[model samples]
Target: MSMFDKTTKMAAVLKGHPKAKEVLESFGLQCSTCSGAKHESIELGATNHGLDVNELLTHLNALFDEPPGK
Candidate 1:
């Protein structure tokens, strides 16, 4: 999948994606289960929370882009 895939839902990211929750918490966002975030895209969340979208994107990518067991 492309790094900037807007179709990725935040809920799915948190549910099955490993780095999502850690990144969110590092940014002081602890409510991954909140209804507003359940259906929103990562970009939407970054915008709403005043976070840098590019930084979030980098973190998300690092989680997925690394070699297995690296």
Candidate 2:
């Protein structure tokens, strides 16, 4: 299983994958402490931020897909 899916919540993703924080930040979503992360889906957040959700999802999933130690 991947670390994140489109429906995955920001909090859950960050909790499960620490490296995800960097990716989220790169996507302009520095919401580590935001309440919305607790319930907002990745897609929703991306949409709200006027970002490309698919690109974000791909980047997020790809980050986890990489072999350990890149």
Candidate 3:
């Protein structure tokens, strides 16, 4: 199962996943540099950004499916 969900904190996601910043950026979320990322959940961020939470989560989780050292 994926480690991230809509309720997962942005900070935790960024910290726990090596490519989280890239994934978030691709979805137009500058979470890595946003102060709110410290406490903001993916759902909240997605809502605020007008992004589909489920789609964002799918892309975020897909980072795990990459081959090692990608």
Query: Each prediction's Cα lDDT score?
Result: 0.72, 0.86, 0.91
Q: Residues 1-70, candidate 2, lDDT per residue (tens digit)?
A: 4667889989988987668899999988987978899989998999999999989988888877777887
Q: Looking at model 2, which ten-residue stretch has the lowest summed lDDT? A: 1-10
- Candidate 2: list runs displaced more than 4 Å: none
Show model 3 residue runs off by greater than 4 Å.
none
Tell me each candidate's TM-score.
0.73, 0.87, 0.93
Under the 3 Å rule for N, CA and C atoms, how many clashes does model 1 have?
A: 0
Structure candidate 2, residue pairs in collision: none
Please identify which of the two predictions, 2 or 3, would achieve the higher TM-score against the true structure: 3
**Model 3: lowest-lDDT 10 consecutive positions:** 59-68
Output the number of the lDDT-best candidate.
3
Alpha-carbon deviation at 45 in model 3, angstroms:
0.2
How are the candidates ranked when ordered by lDDT, highest leading? 3, 2, 1
Winner of 1 and 3 under lDDT: 3
Model 1: residue 27 alpha-carbon error in angstroms = 1.3
